[model samples]
Structure formats: structure tokens, C-alpha cells
Target: MTTATLPARSDLGRPIILLMAVACGVIVANLYYAQTLIDVIGPQIGMSASVAGLITTLTQLGYGLGLFLIVPVADLFENRRIVLGSILVTVIGCLAIAASQGPTSFLVASILTGVGATGAQVLVPLASHLAAPEKQGRVVGTVMSGLLFGIMLARPVANFLAGSFGWRSTFLVSAAAMALIGIALLLACPQRRPRGGMRYGEALASTFAQLRQHRVVRMRAFYQSLMFAAFNLFWTAAPLALIRQFHLGHAGVGAFALAGAGGALVAPVAGWLADRRLTRPTSLAGLAGLSVGFLLADWTVAAGSLIGFTIMAVLIDAAVQLSQITGQKLIFSIDPDARGRINAAYMTVMFVVGALGSVIGSATYEAGGWSASAIAGAAIGGVATLGFLLFDRGASAPR
Candidate 1:
């Protein structure tokens, strides 16, 4: 369990960072690989299409639970241990899902996979811990770009793999990946015992305490929550719109999703800007960009321009990453000693609120169409903009 102690310079300059980044991407991908496969995985496992949504829902819910419970443990334990242990759990979950022949078993495996995938969150704060203050934003940004890649690639990759092999093949591949990533991390990661003296109960209690104690945490969570809501909304509804309006099949939707991956290219740039202390203006631009992207998509969808919609997808995704990177850099700097707990609070609330976007996106698209979903997403962005302008900078802002 003991890792070799390396000097900070070589450690930070070395391959551990890349390992963590790739580890994060692969681990988080476990949460999503089954999302697109659920439709096919369902009937074989005796789950009806109507009830199949729970597969994705339970995974997300399990992720939420991990964000609330497991991520905070990073502050109190050796992070490498937490990271490796999480990988082990996810590998188990993936194997279980691959082998499951019943709906109950598959759903349980999905939840376990979701929970274990939160190792990505721990690795995120660990990136900051590993980097010097001046380099924290850059390091976090690089790693986050990997996380974004996982999110962007999971659906399309799942579809292609499931098509070629089978739905179970995706989970089997994920299990094998975790086994490899876990070994790499086990070898490469350094031992960083956290400085926390808090007990388990106090550490858990402090997650909420940190949110109430820090204005930056509250506002950052608020802004990111809205941005994430807009993100999930556009993504959830856009594919349905493509199918309903343009007659594009799953492959076309996958390609459209792939096109949005280009947006993750901004994550590093945003982080660099944050390192320059440009968070305020960068955040303003992100909010405005999101609103504009949604509006453009609205017009494009009405005009039946698939290319225009794709362009908006890239823009919307870029704006979301910009906002995310900016907020994350700021908040990670907020509480050095409690990065894990604060991050848990930040992400937990953000995702809880963000999940509503999917709900709203589905409802709006089914009820009123893509325009309504876009408008609703735009409204969420506009609200975040107003909050940033009106409240976030209200006299005592850190940035």
C-alpha cells in the first residue's frame, strides 16, 4: 500500500498527472457507457422500455450519493487508496453488469458502477493538491478536459461497441479498462495523507457547513448548477429533436454528439485564463456565450439547419466548459484544507439541480418541441448571468 515518495518537482512534472487524467476519464465513463446501451440491455433483461429509464437514473443517483458520501473521504484518507479502491469497485460493477441476466441485477450493478466512478471527483481535487498554486488551474484544466472527453465519447463509443459486439461488451471492456487503469494508478500515484483531524461525523457534517460558511462556494455552485442544467437540457433534447425533425438515426445523433467534443478544446484555455485571474470576465463571457448558443440553436432548429445546430452544440459545450473550469479553479482555491468536502458540496448540489434539466428537456421537447427546450435552457443561462452580475460580485467577491 506504500508508494514511493518522489520530490514535488518531478512528481508534478511527471506521468502521474496524465495517469490521473486518463484514470478520471475512464472511471467516469463507467457511469455513462450503459446509458445508451440501456434500451438494448433492457428487453433482454426483462425490463420494459418505459421502466428502462431507471437504469440511467439509478446510476446518476448512485453518482450523487458518491459525491455526497465517498468524495469527502478523500480529505481524510490517503487519496491513492481511495482512488484505487474506487477503481476496484467500478471494475466489479462493470463485470457484474456484463454478466447479469436480470433487470434487478443489472440495475444494482449500475448503481455500484455510478458510485465507484466518483473516483474521478477525488482525482480532480488531488490534481490541485499535486500542483503548485500557480499551476493548479492548468493541471486541473488538463485533467478536466479528459473528463469532458469521457462524457462526450461515452454514448457514441457505447453505441459502436454495443453494435459490433453486444450491449454487455461495453461493460466488459470498461471492466478490463478499470483493471488496467487501477494498476497504473497503484504504481504511479504517490502517498499523500490528508491533513484533516476531523472525525467521520464531523467531516460529513462539514460538507454542508462549508457551503454555508463560504459565499464563493454558494455562488459558484449556483452558477455551475444552472450552467450544467442548460448543458443537460440541450443534450437531452437535441438528439430527440434530431430524430423527430431530421429523421437522423442513432448514428447521426452519435456523430452530432461527437461534433460537440470539439468544445472541450476550451477547457485548458479557460483554466489558463483563470490562472491569470481573469475569472470574472471569463465567467461573464461563459454565461453570455451559453445564452447566445441556445438562442442560435433555437433559430437554427426552426430553420431546419442541422449544420447550424451542430455549430450551436459546439458553442454551448464550450461555454459550459468555460464556466465550469472558471468556477472550479476559483472554488478549489477557496478551501485548501477541505477541498474534498467543498467539492462534494459543490458537485452534489450542482448535479442535483442539473438533473432537473434532463427532466425539463424531456418534458419541453415532448410538450412544445426543441424550441421550447432551447428557450428554457437559455432562460437558465440568463438567470446564472444575472446572479453573477448582481450577487457574485456584491462587494466582497474573492476574484
Candidate 2:
């Protein structure tokens, strides 16, 4: 299908994409805010860096649980209500964090925040359902752009706020924003309820059964998990390295993170490529780039050169975003009816891997220094790159 023959904007227009994107961005951003504020929050609550990392770990863990368990409800019930409820839950979580007196409250709040922020996975599938077939890639891409922006920008924004005000203020502001957006979505979006009903057990059984039966889904999920494992490794160590090794302050480290956002801006271009039937090649290319980037980043970090590290940051992040878009495009192609469930399963696995990677990154960095962690991460990416190549062999050829 060519652009000339593409469906009308009414079927998948700028407005719809924009709204979906904003929703996705807002929801997804909630997950990463803790990353930026944790440095500040840790001292305030008397937590160590490793324990602080667990806050993110638990949030990710909660997100994984919510994705597999809660998101499936989108398939059984009306998404508008589910989404509204999720956002409300997020608001509550954020408020809890804002008002917390200690690390325990923050940890619980983080888990709830993760549970509530899963609205993005549901909304992405909803966009795919609403879009014309030929436009699914672009439509998904547009919404993902927002999601990527949220992921990429969350830390920087939180860092900015935390630096300017306090860590608690970040959650208070986020809570208010989530509440406002939840209200707006309730009023503005049209109802999209599930037409078919299935018992909770049936939904769980079917979701797993579908995963077992679908070769494409399994391969895409596996490949994405491996890729994200390495992605999280870098992010987990980035601030620690900057602040400890380079002697940069939180604000400076946050700026370094903001620079990484450059890579996510390519999300739309990745979508266009996938839509034009270049998804497989794009995936392979992205994986290869990520592997190479990891090696370069490892070298830069080991050498203690800020300029080299900065360039590596851009290349590595861009490569990660490209792989992410490619992975989602593949999953989105497999089944529309269960996109949310599929994504939930995929993300649950990946988040688990990511949490493990964060621990690995921190431990490696602390033990053997940046060189050891960077090299290990690069090696992991290389292994995943091989999977990307092999995975493409059995799939439909890219357009």
C-alpha cells in the first residue's frame, strides 16, 4: 500500500493520534519519574543507591504484573472505564508518593504508579483497532512517538523539578496532571467497550495459549526482551557513572539524560520505514546498531572521555528506540484483538529482564567499574543482535 492509496485522516487523523500520543506519553512518563527523583528521595528517606534502584525495580515489576493481569481486562470490558480507573489509580499512587514519610511508602506508591500507568499499552492497542489496516504502522508509530517521548523525557522533567523544588513535589505535580488528564479523557473520548465477554480464567488461559501458538509473537517478544535488557543496563548506570566518575551534579547528569532524547525523535521515521515494508531489515539494522553502539559506549565509558561518552549515548539511545519501534510494529501486525494482552506479556518479560539488567549494571559498575558493566552490556546486545538476525530468517520478508 502506497501513501497515495492510504486511508483518510478521518479514519486515523492528526487529532486522534495527538490525543492518543498525549495519553500514552503521560501514562508512560509516570514509570520513569522515580528514576530522576530517586537520588534526592533516597537521602530524604535514608535509602542507599542499591535500595533506591529497587524502587525502580519494584515499579517495573508492578508494571509487568499489571500488564499481564490488569491489561487483559481491556479485552473483556470497556477500555474507557478501565483507562479512567487506571489513571485514577496512578493519581492516587503519585499522591501517596508526594505525601510519603519514608521509603516504604514510596516503594508502595511506586508499585501502584506502575499499575496505573499501564494505560499506554491499552491505548496503543486501541489506536491500532481504530486505524485502517494500511495506516496501522503510522498510527501506532504516532502514538508510540508520544510513548517514547514520555519515556525519554520523564527523567529529565523529573530531574528538573526535583532539582528546582523537592523530590516530593515531583509526585505531587504528576498526580495533579494525571487527575486532570483522566478527567479530560473521560469527557472527551468516545466509549469503546468490549463486545465479547470471557471469564477471568478463560482470558488468562487464552492469553497464554495464544502466546504458545503464535510463532511471530513469541519471537518478537523474546527479541524485544533481550534488547530491552541491555537498554536498561545503560540507563541504570548512566547517572551513577556521571555523578561518581565524572563528578557531575544531578542537574548535569539529568542534562546528559536529556541529550539521549535525541534518539527517540526518530520514532516517526522508524514507523514510516515499517509502514513501507522495511520492518524486518529495520529491526536487524537496529539490533546491529545497538550492538555496535554498546561497544562504543563501553569504550567511551572505560576511557573516561566525556565527549566520547556523549556521542555513544546518542548512538546507543537512537539504536534502542529504533529496535523498540520495530519490535512493536511486528507485534502490532500479529493480532489486533489481543494487542494489549500481547504487549502486556511482552513487556512483563522485558521488564523482568530490565530489572535484572539494572541490578547487573549497578553491581558490575560498583565492583569492576564502568568498563566491566559496559562490556558486559555490549556483549548482551551482541547476543540479542544474533537473535534479531536469526528471528528475521523465518518471518515474512520486510516490504
Candidate 3:
């Protein structure tokens, strides 16, 4: 694929973009639905506390694996078909989870859900492909805002559903929702077949090649990995902290999660900045905000002020979302033809680190409680801030 083969202008009107955004929200929500339900699902399914923590970790692990293995195939096949196929897998996974009777079955279903949820990744790069170069940042940002909101809201929605109807009902409803979204997307999404002539094997091989060849891809991926690790660490631990320290029930946790969704409002702003070629400065601010948010969270927790803690949650989520969009806009600009593979490489690394962050959050919470988790999160943010200042200070924006 070459520049000449690309569309002269974006075909992504507001309607299609809105549809893509909603689809992304529904698709990505699968990977997170179980996070807040761990306590409810684990006990009913006979899982011990220690093993229950693997619920979130395994889902993320499956997603990371799909990013490495399944996402690259987007470059070798019709993008819409791939997304629809992945959604079918998601439907099956959700049904299996709904029917699960034991820990083994439940965990396995969780993995499948995560793998199938890679459909969101497919839609993102597809959005980039359809948008004109100048509008790519704004379009991707808008779509990602949907995805981020899905992530932020999944916890509360899952909690609310579980509290009202039981955890199994949550999975059942998700399966039905996915099926409907898949049918609508199949009817509406424009078919985009990659012009690259690479075979599937070649496409997978080229992901590694892209990592080596594109310095911006590497830098952006590394920067976001650090921020994303902190993002996961905080979310994973925050619920536990609320339950243990504040005596919040599932409903209370759900309300807290809803408050965090406010941070997703930053996605379009970050995208706007990226379109204006302010990636470096915006990214630095995002990193600094992450550290400051965690520090404020630490203070709020110590003061036992829920309002202050919620405010910090908004800041933390906003900062992480900002950095994410900035990195994505930068990477998407590097190669139009390889957006699938580029996204695969970038997201694979970030989510892999994110999975570790979940595990670390659990372990640290068990070891030293909320203070430890906050400190660990702040330290991760500080590392990212230093990396940006020292190594990526003068990085050039993609033209």
C-alpha cells in the first residue's frame, strides 16, 4: 500500500464515526465486566481470594495474546469481516461465562472474552484508515473516547447488574448486546480490505519488523506502557481499597466507578492537541498529571475523604487517557499501510505490562494496603515522567 492508494479524503462522516464509537464502547467493555464482579463471581464459583485475582489478570493476558497473534491478521483480511468474526467469538465467550459452574470454566471463558474483545482494536485502526490524514487524530480520539468510557464505566455497570440480578446475568446480557452490535456493524461498517499483498504469516512477521524499524512506535509504546501500568494498578486496587478501608459495598463501588468515567472527557482534547502537532508537550503534561493525581490520592486516602479521593480518580483517569490518545495519534501517523500491525505491536506491549500491573496491584494491596498501591502508582508515573524528559524531549511529531 502506498500514499497514492489511500483515499484522497475521509469517508468517515459523523454518523459512521458515532457508530464506530458506540461499537468500540460495547466491544471493549467485555474485557472489564468481570473486574468489579470478582468478589461476587469468585465466591459463588468456589474460587479462593488469591486465585480470584487472576480473573482480571487472565482477561488482560488473553487480550495481550490476541494483540500479538490475532490483530496482525487485520492487515491480511477484510477488516469488517475480522471484526464481525471476533464479535462472534465474544458472544460465545460471554455465554460460556454466564453458564460457568466452576473456577476453571469461568477463567477459561474470561480468556476467550478478552481475546474476542480485540474487535475494539480492529475498529480503531479501521477508523484511522478511513479518516483523511488531517482528521485521523480527531476521529481516532473520538472513537477512543468511547472505548475509554466503556472501560471506565464497565466496572460500575457490572457491579450494578450483579447487585440487581447476580453476576451471571451480567455476562448473559453482554452476550446478547454483543450479538446485536455485531449484526448492526456487519450491515453498516464499510468494507476495508488492506492493499498490502502480504500473506498472514508475512503480516505477523512484519509486526516485529515494524517494532525494530520505527523509533517513534517504540518510544510511544514504551511511554504509554508505563502510564497504562499505573492506570491498571490504580483501578485494580481502588475497588479493594474501597471495600476494605471504606466499607463500601458493591453498590458504593459502582457509584465510585461511575465518577471515574468523567476522565474520559479528555480524549477529544488530547486528539485535538495531536492534530495540532502538540504531542510532546501534551504527553509531558499527561505524565506529570498522573504523578500529581496519585500523590493527591494518597493524601485524600489518609484524610479519609471520599470526595477528595473521587476527584483524584478523575485526574488520574484523565491523565492516563490523555497520554494514551497522544501516543496513539503519533503511532497511527507513522505508517498508513501498517496501522494494524503498528497497533498490534504497540498495544501488545502496553497490555502485557498492564496485566503485570494488575497482578502487582493485588500483591501490593495485600502486602501494605492502599498506601502501598498509591505509592507504587505514583512511582510508575514518576518513571514515565523521567523517561519523557530525558529520552523523548525533542521527539519529532509525525507530519
Q: Which clashing pairs does model 3 show?
A: none
For residues 1-399, write the lDDT of model 1, one tens digit per residue: 234233484458647777777888899988788788877988899999999999999999899999988999888888889989999999999999999999899999999999999999999998888888787777888889889888989999999999999888999998998999998888777777787688878899999888899888889899999999999999899999999998999999999999998898898898888888888888899998999999999999899999999999999999998888888898898767789999999999899999899899999998899989999999999999988888886411324
Worst 10 residues of 1 by lDDT: 1-10
Q: Write the per-residue lDDT of candidate 3 for residues 38-66, one digit (tens) a residue.
A: 87888899999999988987888788778
**In model 1, which regions exceed 4 Å deviation?**
1-6, 394-399
The candidate, 1 or 3, that scores higher on TM-score is 1
Listed in order, each prediction's TM-score against the native is 0.96, 0.90, 0.93
lDDT of 1: 0.88
- The whole-model lDDT of each prediction reads 0.88, 0.76, 0.86
State in Å the error of residue 178, model 2.
Answer: 1.1
